[model samples]
Target: MKNELLSLLNKNLLAVEPSLIRKFDDEISKIPGIIKLTLGEPYFNTPDHIKIAGIKAIIDNQTHYAPNRGIVELREAISEYLRRRHYAVSYDPQEQIIVTNGASEAISTAMNSFLGEGDMVLCPSPAFGLYRNLAKINGARYIEIDTEDDKYELTPEKLKTYLDEYHTSVKMLVLNYPNNPTGVSYSENEIKKLAEVLEEYPIVGECQEVCVNG
Candidate 1:
């Protein structure tokens, strides 16, 4: 039966492994009073106001699927938040904003929109595994740039070396800032160095940053 099920699975999933974090957490969960947050197992409860608002929404028959980009009100609020935080340029809610289930889905969605069969996606490893999975699911290739030797982040010199070696076209490059599980971030000068390397390439990327939920 297990063999038969495997035959029906997507070919792209054949080589994919379940998340190591999730697997370890599941194993430890059997222990008495074990708690984990690596997979975002929240230890806190939902706030009362949020709970009441959700209940009220359900009672008002608001359970229908939202717009493809999600609720305009929420999107607008997010746009405002980004502006308030001075992360980047402010976006128009109706024209630019989207509300995703979480950062995972958001990455999948964006990759699907930009990647196609035989496309190449440059992703630095020692980060989330989902980025690779999403690339496979989109019929694109995931080029894992090992960043262990480079301090868990891609360096400009390494980027240049890969680019020179490949000379192969890249459809997209995924950079996860304030990365998950490690919470590694780039300083201003480090970012400048990376930008200098990328300046040589013709790249088209949306600058909107997705906050990975944990």
Candidate 2:
């Protein structure tokens, strides 16, 4: 029975190597008194008001399944949050937002949505490491672009080189800022430069992939 099960597993299951971040964390945890600068677990707890809201919602029997995209109100909040705090983009809560359990789930879901077997995803190397795993899990190839020389950034020249060299087949590109390991970040000018490169492409959703580590 065990042999039969093993054979079935081999037939059905594709083995993917686990994340380098997770591997590092597992090894680091075993070392006594080792302070991990490896995985980024937010030091601060979720604010009290947010926690209370979750508790109150559950108590109020708001436990039914939400829309596949997520709760409308929550999505709106996310949209507003992004517009108010970071980017100039606005999204329709009903159409454009899908909340997952966490950022990890979000990345995994996005990869699953955009990628399939033989699809190539461009990732900035010496990255958070989880992005590579996410791409792999979707049976997509991870094409790592080394951004080390450009202070770990996605420069216009770099983007141009990849787009020119790869020529249309490569669809997804992931970026990270206030970046892990190096703590490097893009200034406003740099952000605009990257955005300019994106603007010139005009591929609609084809080349629009930016995943910030923060």
Candidate 3:
């Protein structure tokens, strides 16, 4: 039965491997007195205030499943946060804002929504490994833009070169700022230049900014 079930699994998913980040974490966690710096696992515990709020909510029986897009109040807070901190752009919580389980879920959702067989996903090299794995799982070709010469930054010139080569086959561009493993980020000027080049293309940009605050 197990063999039959394995054979029935999606071929694309079968080609995908388990997350390297998680595997590294698992290996390191077995060692006693070892400090783990991999996988972005937080070194500290949840703050007392946040923990207390969660406890209070459970005590109040506020444990029902949230709206598909997430709780209305949480979505509203996200909308407000974007408007204030993210270049003053406003998103309608009711229509545009979606509170995901985490950045991983958000990435998976976006890739599944946009990618298909023969489609291409462009990513800067040395990025989060999940980008490549997700693209493979969705049957999309993942191309890495080698940024070694550019100090680990994706410049407009480099991006334009790839866009010209890939043309319409490129479905998505994964831009991970404060990039995983490398810890490199783009400046405001650098981002604007890249945006100018992107404006001419129809490809979706999956901007992963999870480490921006750190």
> CA lDDT, every prediction?
0.75, 0.70, 0.87
Q: Give per-residue CA lDDT, model 3, range 1-214, as digits (tens).
A: 9999999998998988888889889998999999888878788999999999999999999999989999999999988988998868788899887888888998888888888999999999989988998988888999999999999999899999999999779988889888988999888898888878888888788887321110
Give per-residue CA lDDT, model 2, range 92-141, as digits (tens).
77777778887767666666677777777776676777667777767777
Task: Provide TM-scores for the models.
Answer: 0.82, 0.80, 0.93
- lDDT by residue (1-214, candidate 1, tens digit) is 9999989988877867688988888788888976666676577898999999999999999999899999988998899888887666588899777888876677777877887778787767766778788778777878878888877887888877876765366777777777665677888798778778766775433222642211
Steric clashes per prediction: 0, 0, 0
| Deviation (Å) of 25 in candidate 3 | 2.9
Cα deviation at 128, candidate 1, in Å, is 0.9
User: Which pairs of residues clash in candidate 3, taking residues 3 or more apart in a chain or in different chains?
Assistant: none
Better of 2 and 3 by lDDT: 3
Candidate achieving higher TM-score, 1 or 2: 1
CA deviation > 4 Å runs, candidate 1: 1-10, 86-88, 204-214
C-alpha displacement of 196 in model 3, angstroms? 0.4
Please give the lDDT score for candidate 2.
0.70
Worst 10 residues of 3 by lDDT: 205-214
